[model samples]
Target: MDDLNAIATLLTKPEPPAEAVTRSRGRLQDRMRGRARRRIGWLLPALTLATAAAAAVAMLVTGVITPAGAPASGREVLLMAAVSAERTPQGSGTYWYVTREMRDMDIPRQESWTTRDGRRWSKGEPGDPPGVVVPDPDPLMLKGAEVSIEDLEKLPADPEALKARLAGLQGRDSAMTASEQRGDPLFSLITLISELPTPPEVRSAAFRALATMPGVESTGAVEGGHELRFPYPDTTWEVKLVVDPETARVTRTNSLSGNDGSVLLSAGFIRVTTGWTDQPPR
Candidate 1:
């Protein structure tokens, strides 16, 4: 059809007005432009594939894509796990069954030296047993075989009481406070976090606390949200936590920044996909 049109144009010799010739030339230019556009459009996918291949090569050379979806250099594996049970009819209330695999660093058995707290004792040098050090039972265990927002509701609702209870925890004794400046800022900030509320303040107090911690970032939703971050140089030690909007209960919690993930250090939501199914404990 295009060939026929071209032959017809070549054979036709009707006298042409200058304006008509100009119009004919303009139409030919328009048709040629359209064809050029179609040809470019056909190359778009090839161009895109080539661009993607270049980016993949660049990332591979820069070590951005590590083994097993792990973050590249300067980042550490932030493994997390959460368990919730007894889904409510409204589909809004679910009991937080467990948030294990938190960070806890027990200085190597051999590296443990003791402090003179009324008596001199050795924590044992490396390669030696942890010695006669007694283990403090986890309070979370005694709270219940299963924990819920309702259970926390029964506790003293007073923030002061809550602060006192939290302050009494093992690491709290060494916790630095706002008044305890001049010392380690990290320890002081950790103590202050013990007073955090379900939906973080996001304003004066919470904002100020977050500022003191490093690598600490945040995101939120209309109703509720959280912020997980690390205050230290190491990426392995971090905090993860979430809250129940209505009851203000800590619904999800875990951490991975410590040597052994067991301690609740930071509080925030993390990106993950978890499923709920009742299965007997192994």
Candidate 2:
């Protein structure tokens, strides 16, 4: 079995030593940070591939699984996120507004805002204009022909049925190769659910749906909050969702490259403030 599968199998067995968990988490975090600092472009591909292989071996030796059948750790986390999302007050407004700060390895700090009605505004740097609406299609990209806020609201809350519908939609994308289409269904579903301006129930259902996917793993608690990770499509990097257990809402989503332990991308709304104001963000 691979590292992930080994961890899953071990999770079904007995708990590893607390020391082992610490070691595993430390190794993963350290490796990610080290990769982020390196700037050599050509060596990255080889380094990433080698890193993924080494990580699998490290997982096996570290024995990172919790007690088997003791309730999946990831499922519990997701359930909590679902409940938190359900309780979160959806602001009353003609349009939904989200503001967030983004940081990457070499990129300067950027602040941005997005509206549910498909408008994007941003500030380039600290001294730049606070807000200027940019003509961009990214917000609309969140809603496809079949999957929209309206469509998501109609989706069944049942996990299995919801997963199946997401799978069916995968084939509708004519641009993807057959191999890509056959990749992880949960990835697409989660991406769509996370980005779209869906109802609270729909958002809740999405988390609940993810709880049912096999091989999902929980990293217990990290610096900001609890983390639940899912394997990505043909990549060593994992898709990580950081949830504030106290509030049960996802604070951030990260594409963590396993090879160099660097983050490929991170996205989330830092604050969502909505009201009946027709004026655009100033």
Candidate 3:
């Protein structure tokens, strides 16, 4: 029923099983619409990568999670990301496009194009059964306080003022998680940096705010970028964001448990690219 999905192929990869790709598509659908996660068993991963993306996939690798007593390196890493984001040009197009794939899983890749008014179109790996281009109408969940793309664009660019704006918007929803209830502006503003379609200045503000948050640490490098870990109040696990400061994009994110301190891919995704494109969604 859609023509826009026929746009150029987006990713290069060996193909995956058709069944797995179909299932992945449905799960992705649930996420795009702001619905609660359906537990397929194993622990329910943290909500950091939930909206606009899934939790993670790889599991059970041992690591460490310690609060940074003096996080000079950590501060520097985020500050660098802030500078990089400011320098990077923000491009606009007819549709906002994102290409994401489940990490370490055999599921096929997925792509989406969101219209300016928030209508979304998604397609799974090539040659899977044809699926309709459904529009996900739900607004983004800013850890409880709902916001449209337009509202996110209006956020302030100054770090302190941006935190203040999110703080004011929090607590409006009664069903907010325990983390959201605690009123952590650092946590709330981070969604803006990682996945939202905010302006580069807004993202720069978020990175600066994250730099000053207590217990954030630069945990050394990964394959594509270095790992940045930070504590979340009232949660047993700290958050790990694998980011390339030069590009100012989060490549991967997941929770590091207090005990084992492992990075589990079963809970999140590897975001290949998210940006505006003239590419149409079928």
Candidate 4:
């Protein structure tokens, strides 16, 4: 009981230097802004709002006193993202081309193109030939099947219907164990849609659908944006979706493993620049 009391006392101890805390908060905010520009492609006019929200989060986490006004919650963030997506401008092109960066366990920076029709292409890194087209044998798989532009367009735009469809797919895969099947379908949907050239309305629907899922909780604001934590069924890792509420788009996503906080995968994708390009990728 004495040892337990000692641990509790340490946990409740006052934090160190206010100046240090303030500096840390500022750095975090700056990092978030930089990430927003790189990952989201564009910043919304309401970036000040995002800054304030991030400040509120820093104060809350560090036990610093903050001004009044309820900090945005996870559900509110998702819903706001939906609204933002709805207001986004649509694009037109002969072929949908998306540029993205993905970091998995092995690769730190893997830049690539995602095509609506599943054609593989990538921009060569510095010192490599520009516009190198590589044949990617991989298919754009969603919900255990290959997806095309037509498939994405056919997806339900209503939140409830979309949620139901995602939930229905949970147990349909016979190969997945029951535990593996319990993964958050809403997250999968978001990741898939972010990589595709979906219409603004469809993307909005995807955000709304996420808002309706159980266990979707906010971890408050971080550096780049607000984060939503989704627990996968029977897994130690949780999926975190960082969203820029001002732009109503996902800025970054990561799967964090175990108590040690190891990252399994991180992907940053944007479709804002995607359009039908008559010029084929070289």
Candidate 5:
């Protein structure tokens, strides 16, 4: 279909090569789309052609091949990210500033600044327009209630406690439809960690909470990120996120595929920049 949504510019990955590819190459492409995985190092020039051909034939005959060792699943990847996030130094300043854009939408990018204590918030317009200080409508959803930045600091660091606290937020989320209320609470956690400046330990707890969620699964890998799919109430389409495990940042909301082909859908704001800033919104 020629619909814009069918080819939305979400996640902003490099375009695939236009030329036709062979089946062996197609196999590799399929793996990139979520399947068996194997990390092959550089092929030595001295290796015999027969040996290479034999390996190719084996992969062809037996679907995808993985050498010895446990393949990394989505949960394992998230757990690894949790550890990475745990060790990262936390940032501190007067305000937590954020720049975000909805890639698939035509609206202008938005910027925001919130006092560390969450007492005040401001919305910045595109270009040089001055930021308008707004009311404290920026409470984070947790345990079916609104939570301020001060409360965020006091959240439990334990994965299980954090999970219970953030998961139920989705039920009370006004943005979610009645049907969406039945969706996974991981959605709430992911949204918070992706854009909000939660404490490093709290972010780690959220990652750990997601790791233990029942249906979180590795869909595949993306350049500079790992893609994981989560359960949503809607069955018509799938929800996947491209996450940078090193920084524990969710880079993109989703990259979905269908019978026709893959459709890149970006439903949420792409966090362009977020961290503590001493300077006021410029």
Candidate 6:
């Protein structure tokens, strides 16, 4: 159709012979061509404007805006497209959780628990007293049990040394025998070990720790800053960690990408602005 239009435009350029114009209904044909050109000229802008508007609407709805500089207060914000989950202060030192499930990934399942650090735990191990369950537990299950951040600190100060210990621990364990398996403490230990700023020798161990995590992938640095990317059932998300450079303690975080690659649902990013506070969410 475009080709035909182009040809018609070329043919009508000089309006044909004026003497040949009145011959054999040429005048009528010329009139039809003139009317067609006028109609096409009007339609083009309307279509272009409509296309631009649709693109703008899609961007707004997807939340794919360029993020601003990282926040200051050691507070963290995590977003999965328009849906997001945040850990904030409920009061001076206490924390709370707020999550918006825009994609319905079944993340806030009935089997959920809370950690002392204020993060929500879903799919815990058996008899484990309901903590976070590392979802993917193949090749590296049977580890001892979960432990706390403080407990991990009690272990070796060397990250490399600690990782070796973790590998050995996970190797001896077997699959859960019952619901009690859900409460295993290794998940907590894994979290602690992965988040800590360990020596280079232990960096591989941190990656290994993150690998055994049910839904977590890699925890490392990106663009010269620390980053953690985790996989939800339907989406994989990236987060930039905000840390106290001196303490190696993560102060806050920002979401990098939502739905980087997944089979289910819309695979795209949404943009949002957030602020973190020292206090916890209520």
RMSD of 5: 14.5
In candidate 6, how many Å is residue 206 off? 2.9
Pick by TM-score: 3 or 6, better one? 3
Judge candidate 1 against the unseen true structure and give its global Cα lDDT, from 0 to 1: 0.27
Best by lDDT: 3
lDDT of 3 by residue, 90-126 (tens): 7889777766666566766666677778776666634
CA error at residue 20 for candidate 4, angstroms: 37
lDDT of 6 by residue, 1-282 (tens): 442223223322443344432341333333323432112111111112222222222222223221232111111111110111011111222211222222223333223223345353333223323434532221111233443324443554232455456444432224322211333333323233223212322332233233343444223222212234343322244332322121222333332211111012223211112222334322
Candidate 6 — worst ten consecutive residues by lDDT sum?
A: 77-86
Candidate 5 lDDT score at position 278: 91
Q: For residues 1-282, write the lDDT of model 5, one tens digit per residue.
A: 321112122112342233322444444444434533343222112212232233233223222333323234676567656655765777778878766556566766666677765654545543334545455454444434455787777777777777666545434444544433654455567655665677888887788777777777875445335667776555555566766665667766643221121122455524355778798755
lDDT of 1 by residue, 51-91 (tens): 22222232232223334322212111110000000111112
lDDT of 5 at 254: 49
Instruction: Give the worst 10-residue stretch by lDDT in candidate 2.
Output: 255-264
Tell me which of candidates 4 and 5 scores higher on lDDT. 5
* Superposed Cα RMSD, model 4: 13.4
- In model 5, what lDDT does residue 208 have? 73
Better of 1 and 4 by TM-score: 4
Q: Write the per-residue lDDT of candidate 2 for residues 46-86, one digit (tens) a residue.
A: 12423332332333333533333232277666655555555
For candidate 5, the clash count comes to 0
lDDT of each: 0.27, 0.48, 0.56, 0.53, 0.54, 0.28
**Candidates' TM-scores?**
0.25, 0.56, 0.64, 0.60, 0.61, 0.25
Model 2 sits at a Cα RMSD from the real structure of 11.8
Q: In TM-score terms, which candidate is top?
A: 3
